[model samples]
Target: MTSPHDALFQWTFSQREHALGLLKAALPRPVVAAVRWSTLRIEKGSFVDRALRSRHSDLVLSARMGAGRIYFYVIVEHQRDVEALMVFRMGLYMMRLWERITRDRPRLTELPPIMPVLIHHSDTGWTAARAFQDIVAARGPERAALLPHIPCFELLLVDVSAGRAGDVVEEALTALGKVVLWCLSVSGDDARLEREIGHVAAALDEVLRAPSGLAALEALLRYLLATHERLSVQKIGGILEKAVGPQAQEAIVTELDEIERRGRAQGRVQGRVQGRAQTLLEVLTARFGSVPAEVSARILAADEATLVTCTTRVLTAPTPQEVLGDDGPRVSPARRPPARKRARRT
Candidate 1:
């Protein structure tokens, strides 16, 4: 299953208005007031470590400030638990960004300063270090002395659990940011998600006013389906119809139905296959220390019936061979009609 938190965060902040609003909300009031919001330009790709990219999604936005430019690297961390290595990871990403710029722009004399912002929305809240030096092993005077040599960076923390996200959205002057924040804040709770459907609808209405209105609507519909279990095709379509006019609703709902149909079908198939595979593997592991390649391949490739049979046999069978033996129950033959009946009628 696609993680709801990850999906929502990526979809929301990908939009320019929402990202701009996020920056304003997360940054210091003095820093936020200094910049021209209109000049905010999103940097296309991320420089985060590939291994950790699956859990942490990032976006880099840069803006013109007089003769100089400033870069904002927004790192969205979706994991529920505290990540001890987060500060180190952030530092690495910053270095990678600088490396890429240096390599790409060889003649440029100066690299724009990068400000790293960390947004987390875990239920348990953040308990990890906010600075790179905090996580390091060195301490006392030695640590203080080494600080000058070491790259020390502080993360601007936005803990969504503390209600900053909701406040940001409500306070934002734009519709896109409000909608994006609305989706992110209520993603974890089914009851809240359902209750706030009207608000989401209103936000969608606002989003649909832009030139790329239809495209935006489609994105929102997809995000809702991917993140929420309670939103069926029919429920979402109905909600859209009410929030956005019937014309917009018709366009979005058709796509939503097809996407949901495929998603649910695939989910069911994957769930069954994984459940059976795990059960078989567990049983084999319990009886035999290891499962040979051929045995594992057969078990994994087997149909539902074959898995059930093997699962039953594993409990009583003395050897792995017996559990997966060739000599087993054969499928029943198709029944044949009485031979004499046709001849008698003729």
Candidate 2:
């Protein structure tokens, strides 16, 4: 079975060059030219472990700019959903890179800047770092406050659900975006989204055959189809067949099928465990008003049989106190716990 980490690694490495081209287009002219002047190295695995400990980042690109006098690092983290830890993780990576560079080149006068870019397909609004208080305080109270300003991370948020069929390159990016959004969307009518996604997929098929775009498109499509649960290999393959050719479509389908089989097996095991835990928690909450944090944690960590038994007890228990063994409330099963006390904590 291919782990999420493995899948992510494959996805990132596959599109490393294509993503680099996109980044180059977005960078300042001098920086882009200077960076291009020197060799751009794609470093993966333990090389970047000090910066990003996990394999979640799709690509890490580093190059020497300014006549090979300075080193610039760009870390691209890709995701189908919003992760709260992204900010902290990027901050950690930046700090680690700085430390390593300084330690390695102690005599250097200055270090190059680091840019963290998030390529996300979430429909949820994206937010960057807040600088209101910091900016205001920098000039207001203590002129010497001297707090280092937080670096601004760029967010390339493309929500496919908001786009329509258009230019090939734009459509390709949108289609990739939609494929991700489709995977993450869990509510309402998905028919429209699916239809649009198919259109994008068809466009991607043609892009994959083009000499200039073929490699990148194939890599991106492979990654999207493999990691996203919403995209089936058959659907994507059909699109590829229409866009590219049967031979390429067959190869992609085979790879996707293997990935899906592994993912499904793992998902089934996880789902069973999660379902039982949820059932236990629901039952406990019903009978005992609200499950305490410690109790909930215990439930989550409990074995499957234990959770199943707890669920059974919850269904049969008449009152809150019965399930909790006399320590809980004596309220009816439908009665909820106190508003303030029952609120869930992270």
Candidate 3:
């Protein structure tokens, strides 16, 4: 199944306004100024072939600017958690896209620029490798000597879960765009999401009246429904009505019917268990930089009660090992985040 986070991101960022705003906000100002904004367009292609989503050619998700001999691609990838091997993955993706671009223009000699962007939202900020060489296994001081041969390019990261993303979008995006981003930053975690609903409701209200507002609202509602389990549908409806005026119910009826039916049909115990295991692994990986093979095996084989305990501890645990150990990590860290740096005297 396509993840709800990916679905919401693909839908919201596909719009012209949000897509343009995202590229502007994430890319270097020099790069942004060089582009011809009027020619910008999201590439629409088939996803069946799975070779860079087949149709997108340049990326699984992408937009292009410039044209003919001058054109380049801006690739967008979204995530709810940090992936340890993302740098390696992006390197391969960029190459695949480059290969496709080469085939398209047989006379092409110089490769066009392709900037791969990663937009991730989680309670913890991004902590994975942004450059391919960072994840390369190198031992001793000789590793530094090997750097000259290793390919290196950093992926731009738009960490929407942090306060700075808010700053970027606040000035550049439309109301609907802001609502989509706000949802992305908080949707998966129930407590944080509940606390922030009112803040989003205000922007969401504005979105409801804008052109194609109902469609945007439907996407938001779908995200919330898929992500939240404790938040009752009745309460959400009431909030929408009070925040968005009387038309809210009528506007969302089609989405509501579809979502409700899907939810009922998918209330299977086996699926729920698998989901818990996957979510736990994602959380562990995001929290601790990476998970060990044994730790992953334990999690996969864990019972429902063990999963619940580990899930609760993941929020505060300093390391993945502590989740399965008697000595808990939920209380204290063995080392500070910037452990390599010495404290400076005042």
Candidate 4:
């Protein structure tokens, strides 16, 4: 089953206009207005594949709003959690894209500039670039360097747990953020949250009703619900009611329930597998004083057949040594080695 987070990630990039709107809302006014946004399709054989294997970016935007000006490129990468290698990955993508453009257009004057954007939802502090020198300095020498200064990408992080919904949206988007805050604040018991949910749901419904927005809205809802596990059907229904209307709430509820059911099923399967692995470890530890780290890891990684065999051995072994084979010392043998004695200090 596809996770909600995965669905949101997909939704963010699936529609060019939706992605453009998000960028316009998040970035500075001058930059947003100056760019005419559109999606960029990266084929399998393209240079983008050298750096990234994925078919689509979280969002790929092109800016062409300026008159008689070269259109710039922006690639937005969204991540639900913190990724340690994010900077390195972005660097690779930047490098590959730059190389491709340069190859296609030999003249430096002919190449258009590109920008990378990273959108993350994590509490931990993260930076898009590790070293300032990578952005400022050229690879070999100061004067003869091919590319001296590549504009470092921007990092837009949303920490859902840190603040109120209004604050979060405000920090990201002044107007729409308020809408998000209103939708999130609607409480089940409190009539205010319920009303707010209805309002937001109506707006969302209007957007989704449009042929272009339908797919995008579906993707966004899936992502939001998946990422925010605490979100309930009532809360979602409220939002849908406001965005899409009361009539669409039923369909939304059904979809949310289906998603929840799938998530629970996946969690249960994982729990069972982990439980069995832990049980096997405990049984081994009880039979043997301490199992070797490598052996224990192997046991944990073992299939059902291996686990059953080891479990049987654990129950039937007469002594700890028998359970662990020759690697372990005999516990009850009469010919056991004498305990080493410490020498008296002079």
Best by lDDT: 1
lDDT of 2 by residue, 187-237 (tens): 222354344445445545544445534444455555545454575666655
| lDDT for 245 (candidate 4) | 54
TM-score of each: 0.63, 0.49, 0.63, 0.46
Order candidates by lDDT, high to low.
1, 3, 2, 4
Stretches > 4 Å off in candidate 1 = 1-14, 107-110, 139-143, 162-170, 196-204, 208-213, 235-346
The digit string of per-residue lDDT tens for model 1 on 171-232 reads 64357666655665555465666666676576667677667766666666666666666767
Ranking by TM-score: 3, 1, 2, 4
User: Once model 2 is optimally superposed onto the true structure by TM-score, how far is the C-alpha of residue 165 displaced, in angstroms?
Assistant: 14
User: Per-residue lDDT of 1-346 in model 3, one digit per residue for the tens?
Assistant: 5556657777877677777777777677777777777666766542222643411222243434455423333433344557788667667766766777788788987887777776667667678888888888997899989999999888787777846474363656677777777777876677766566676576776777676876787788877877776777765655566555555556655556766777776767557777899999998888787788978999998877888888988887667888875574443465546557677999
Which lDDT values do the candidates have, in the order given? 0.73, 0.51, 0.68, 0.49
Clashing pairs in 3: none
lDDT of 1: 0.73
Candidate 1: clashing residue pairs, number: 0
Using lDDT as the yardstick, the better of models 2 and 4 is 2
Q: Alpha carbon lDDT of residue 94, candidate 4?
A: 63
1 or 3, which is superior by lDDT? 1
Instruction: Please state the error at residue 184 of candidate 4 in Å.
Output: 13
lDDT of 4 by residue, 1-346 (tens): 4334334444443444344444554555566556655533322322234334232243344555554223223332333235555555666666676676678668766446555554443334343454433445455665344444444454433333223222132333422333332322332224444444544554555455554454444555554554445766556545565556554555566556666788899899667767777887887777676877766777667665656666677787765334434455545677877989999999
lDDT of 2 at 19: 46
